[model samples]
Target: MAASVEHDSLESMEAPQTAVEVEETKTFKDLGVTDVLCEACDQLGWTKPTKIQIEAIPLALQGRDIIGLAETGSGKTGAFALPILNALLETPQRLFALVLTPTRELAFQISEQFEALGSSIGVQCAVIVGGIDSMSQSLALAKKPHIVIATPGRLIDHLENTKGFNLRALKYLVMDEADRILNMDFETEVDKILKVIPRDRKTFLFSATMTKKVQKLQRAALKNPVKCAVSSKYQTVEKLQQYYLFIPSKFKDTYLVYILNELAGNSFMIFCSTCNNTQRTALLLRNLGFTAIPLHGQMSQSKRLGSLNKFKAKARSILLATDVASRGLDIPHVDVVVNFDIPTHSKDYIHRVGRTARAGRSGKAITFVTQYDVELFQRIEHLIGKKLPVFPTQDDEVMMLTERVTEAQRFARMELREHGEKKKRSREDVGDNDDTEGAIGVRNKVAGGKMKKRKGR
Candidate 1:
């Protein structure tokens, strides 16, 4: 406890010094980034450094370990990537750096950023995560990539089992989303990983909030780190217009459809509390003729990545996701966010709403608050330091949606039950190939029952 307090004080005291120094540095080149990397940043359309990048890049270039505190969408990846790429340039070697992330999605996203930034230098990166074949990963490790981005559990699996592979000469280590990494209870695996990596390597820890677990991890991992905090307080971006809708739990789907129609032509992300709810709501929306998709922990990794790619490509306009998509995965063009279920924790409210209004763009967020979620909604309001205005709706117009939504709900439930049976049978007869293509075909066969739009809202 005493050490954590001392660490907090030290971080607070040193945070401002770097903030003051960052003002004079306007560009990545000004922050000691190499000419090649600056050009690569230009090609990627990053004209200027973000706040986190501006603060951490210069210090990292000077060979100092760093602890960065920044919110989601604050360009934390660039802050750590630039320094690691720069170091690799000066002293090029395979397996030069390792980044440990909390989720497979986040790990893949980081690898994409690294490859983009280091395109000119021919930097190779391997993503090691779960739900994928380990045999293929063994081949990737055999080829000796320059950087390895991974989750803790799978990385430990490789360290113990993979033949002729090690990180004894690694020069840099990064734990992105350090707080979430610890919160998911990967502490034992993380400890095991730390025991093997070289203590002389530089470590950079980036997290949204500083929890006790994160503070403890900082002491265990980083060495005399300089703290670079962009926003220590929990708050949403200025361009976000947040609102709430209070309705009965039974009428939740009706209100959701009304809102989607009201905000047509805009891309949306809807947050749900459970995987089952996410899948059910997605089927319901799809039956109503909306371009809806589901992303949850239960799906195969290829399907999960396919869902994200389809959403990003705008082939699908609505993504119904559990909290798995909430943190550290960047999809920059979201125009609105809907909290279909209010988060039990207030801090998640910030991250969910943060998905939109990103990078100085204007966006909206509407949260659905059922009677049972009053206390949760109030806690969210308290955390954000303001009461959300009610989203205007004509009760009669919403009521008109009830019959159509109810019909769609019936179809959705039927499809879900049939899909579950198919999955079970497939697992017994063959491998778990549970293809969504056949499921969608079935929906098309029953498309005659889908309700047509009622005129004159």
Candidate 2:
């Protein structure tokens, strides 16, 4: 009964009748954003503001604390960034704003967007996250970049340890993906951060959903924030074609290979349930001569960024990842999202499929459901409020590749075992403390070449 009541309350929050309606075609200049930032927006190809931006920007410029509830792929970044940049232009202060994200990849992605939008104005943003070196990050913080983007735990470490580094005068605080942050159980760190930052600052909390924890944090962090909600209900866009395939558990790899062959010219972001599975799938796909890369929690930060940059640059066509990539890392050219393993939680299904069909581009999401996954699959359908159509498959052709897939799977398993052993040996050789929480190795640098002179801007 309590769950049902909570569900109803969620429904009400999602489809609120009293929410402010924003004009879809509103421009940034009309939203009271300065002409210089408007030029930055134009350079980034944002001719008009998104719905969330339209609603939040004007109020944000008016100095209102904001709680923006919008779905994945919505322009939540811009809704917070433009206003922050606009404010930075006025004040021109270092360590002006702090943007907190859930994951390292999301932190990097947000930093990229902030840099791209603030480039013309010479905005420097530092990213602080785990699996990266503290010394380098300390150097970055020493420089006192105008903006600091960080994950909670790592940021807390710095706050406590890094000398002469504090956000005492921070003008703005943004909790991007606030729901995920709480879900990851970073409440203690967030509480610590809240205690340290000045109380006279503007706070913007943006989340895909309004949960009890987010509400609690909002009350604690914000002072009468304006609610900007673009999507009150959980639903995929019309352009996303979602489908499911019921197959035997053992033949999952074969089906994936068959699908990749069938959908040849398109890039794919395949979701797996475990880090081992992600690595195995990438190895399997690569063994078959496909340019597949893996990203998961266990990987070092540099490799993770390398994989993401490779995918973003189209150097790799297929990316196999765990839920780390699901929430906020936006890759523009993902043509298909293959759920190689159906998510256990129904809500995760929404985020996994959200990778594609973003920013008005049509895309496909296919989920593999085994006999044991019927109940879970049913739960996802119930959550989405619709029955998914069956994705067409050639079973005979899929069976034809089973032998090759089995051999590849064996190779993948062996590789995983060897990799695990190597990790175990390394841990034994160099005590665990050597890999400090946020310690990062040298990044793989891009090759430098002579610059071709360009015409004046």
Candidate 3:
């Protein structure tokens, strides 16, 4: 009887969470993938491949140039990785594969995936990134890895100075997040790096967003590529519990804290609009006796690395980060995602929430909505083509909301202190200017009055 009541309650929610999209599944062996790869997949507990993987892997193994457009977390990496490994397993010598990513995090991530896929067998992998010494990178390259995963700037740096990168022997090239790496203002660097590579190679491109800039770059990058589109823009995650809390603007943080304390998991991310907002939110969360950390662009490289390490280790339960810092970073065991600040880009919302509900797991995506965030939320909903349901908390959750009120008081005090300091500084500067101007004028007026009094006497 209670289950029926709860089911009705869930159903009444506007954009209720649905089940995952049904896609046809096939085993790796059934897809014509090698037994060695199939064995690894089974070992990893991957019984069957995703739709994108099922379609793209066979085409890739055929040595065909392909353009794969899929949603974030659609297992696109495996689509390319499996085929690359199969091709390289035949000829293990010489650097044969190059994958370009926009960020260093992704470079390391892809390199790790490549290593993992070939761990049963033997596959040599090298990663090119910045903020590290080139000597170490050169050393990694000197061993002549089978696959090289790299960011554009670091690749260019290595090409201009390092001698180990031999593109003539390269047989496969992939631009992961092709729009971010291959086009935009940053694309000039990617274009220059592309010119350094041999054109007679099998090219693979993948990204969440496919703009005209990417299409033009694709023409120049590939030799008549095959296009595959899997997910459309703003596609909703069916297994995710999607809802919003319609609270007053001032009480948003309170309501958010209420939900966070009630949720039954550790290791989650809160999306913020900017680095400052992310930092401020982290500090607020920390003040509430919860383990929270901030991630954003303003943070130093070492700090960002440290934050992610801590997050992965479960040292921090909640990570308050902006979208820019969170991109291309895949963290395991993220239980829930909170949209503290609505994403400026609708696509970013997809990436932010994709952190959870990954690898056949059920997760919840909760958003705190205010008047300020309504339009932005609408944009997100419109893009995803779903109206989310409104969900209110239970009785035990009320205490957490009280704690958030306390936190808001602290935030107000902090803001007031900053405002007071700014006003104090401005008042002091104005006082000094007034004193300087009065000095000469006061003396002249005094002298003239004194002279007039003496003459009258």
Root-mean-square deviation per candidate: 5.2, 7.2, 16.1
**How many backbone clashes are present in model 2?**
3
Q: How many steric clashes between backbone atoms does each model show?
A: 0, 3, 4
**Candidate 2 Cα lDDT to native:** 0.85
Please tell me which model should have the higher TM-score, number 2 or number 3. Answer: 2
TM-scores for all candidates: the values are: 0.91, 0.89, 0.78
Q: What is the lDDT of residue 6 in candidate 3?
A: 43
Candidate with the greatest lDDT versus the true structure:
1
Candidate 1 vs candidate 2, TM-score winner:
1
Badly placed stretches (over 4 Å) of model 1 are: 1-23, 429-457
Ranking by TM-score: 1, 2, 3
Lowest lDDT block of 10, candidate 3: 434-443
Q: Report lDDT (CA) for all predictions.
A: 0.86, 0.85, 0.72
